[model samples]
Target: MKHLNTFNNTILYDFMELFHSLPYTFLGMEKSKDAFESAKVVLLPVPYDGTQYPYKGAANGARAIIEASRHIETFDDELNLELEDLGIYTLDELEISLESALETIKRVQEAVEEILDNKKMPIILGGEHSISLGAVRAINAKMENVSVLQLDAHADLRNEFKGCKYAHTCVMRRINEISHYVGVGIRSMSKEEKEFIEENELDIYGTNFNSNEILEKLKDKVYITIDLDVFDPSIIPSVGNPEPQGLFWIEILELLKKIAQEKEIIGFDIVELSPNSNKISDIYAAKLICKILSFSFFSKF
Candidate 1:
């Protein structure tokens, strides 16, 4: 329902360094029809961060990441190649009114299905952790054997919560309906979720669990879903739910690198970053997306 404001537009302009005198898109380049579709990877931004426990504004997560992306160097110093070589595509956000979360999830599911049907991997930036439900369903529409790699502070496996069956608390429970998954860096869990896991014999590795054990359990083609709360609050305090202690940025990077080395990451989503005017969190989220994209390519090479 809310679009970019003038101040936000000005910020985007400065970051992109574009010649506004001429008609151009975000990166100050012409929209490449062929190059865009032929792209191996696609970025989908869904600005619908609803159903929060602590803070609000994760709805702004997509815009914040896209804005900060302008500051990203096209040529990766670490990989020593232009990311454009992989043919990245960025789409305008699909329509959503933010009135109902369930309706938004259905819309997301449709958009995600289109991406998967095209045979291109989708990197969805979240409005909330609930957005993962649509992405998980999107993958299920086509793949025979798919597994989710959830990196979060809490186990989002509740069958229902807050009188909402499709609450953010129930995202993983919905994913469980379609396929198996591996949960990593989990430091929060409820008694109900614990019983559900024990009874179903699910693949869950808590914060106390070993990374190596979880890595080996992943399937060949995987969909990764990250709730930003997985990071220690000291490191990423701007998320909706700030858990005291969790994984470090580099530790997550290393974990992703290991997963990329071992499995094919079909899709991913980074949810629950509520940006502030301070701007550090925005750039951090952007860098995280860029790093994951780079890792995805570097591992294959």
Candidate 2:
């Protein structure tokens, strides 16, 4: 691994403490991307999970994930590179009051638009899958040449979930309206989603297909989003929407690496972690987010 060490070879716990003390700050320097107004990568945290049925902790998912990121080393052994040096800006959590899901999406859309207008790559920390509707819509409006990669266990292609068209169950269906999306790790689906999948011929699937194969089939640029429920409920049970079976960390990393190698990821997000005092789950979410940024932005830069 090509670790360009900037910090001293300090203790891991000390490093975690440093990262935890200021969860969102870059390098313990009270650093803000405000200085680099033209930063390429932007991290947006949306901690609202207003409509999550039976699960309430996803509302705190963004904060918990950010907190856990402190212990993450800058270097990624798999990618053989260091992160953080690439100038990925972490935005303070967006103000999402007790608003309707539709309203929250509008708010998220505006926030993502501001970041994208500056030509920055947005890595959104989602409150729910619905938040993606706004971000994807804005990105679609700005750039017509991009594709969406929806990662989750559920198809999320239903026309509506219960009475809400904007439920997590329909998030990808919403994405279908804005962009050509390819879904991976979809093991669950509503009837409407099944109908839509069959009618529209969506690439929603259950197995870990070859990333290179998928990449070759896709266009050159992509927007990657992950709803943590994509992993099996066994390993990552702390999600708002838990599923029966799913992908492992290495499997996910491999696909992400291939995407980074083969395409330009215009934007991305990791959402739906619903931690319940399980420190490992929160830490896992945080470290995974850090690892993703490392492979997708930091390591490459």
Clashes per prediction?
Answer: 1, 0
Q: Write the per-residue lDDT of candidate 1 for residues 1-301, one digit (tens) a residue.
A: 1455877877887876753442222222235788666688777888886676656798888878777777667677987767767776778876765677788888888988998888888989878888888888888887866789999998899888777767688899988887889998888888999999899998887666666887778888889998888887777777887777798888888888778777778889989989887677767777777777777788564
Q: Each model's C-alpha lDDT? A: 0.79, 0.76
Candidate 1 residue pairs that clash: 49-127
Error of 2 at 41 (Å): 1.8
lDDT of 2 by residue, 36-141 (tens): 5745667788988887877677878877777667656656687666565566667888888685788888888899898888888787886778888889988977
TM-score of each: 0.87, 0.86
| Model 2 global lDDT (CA atoms, 0 to 1) | 0.76
Query: Which stretches of model 1 miss by more than 4 angstroms?
Result: 1-18, 21-30, 299-301
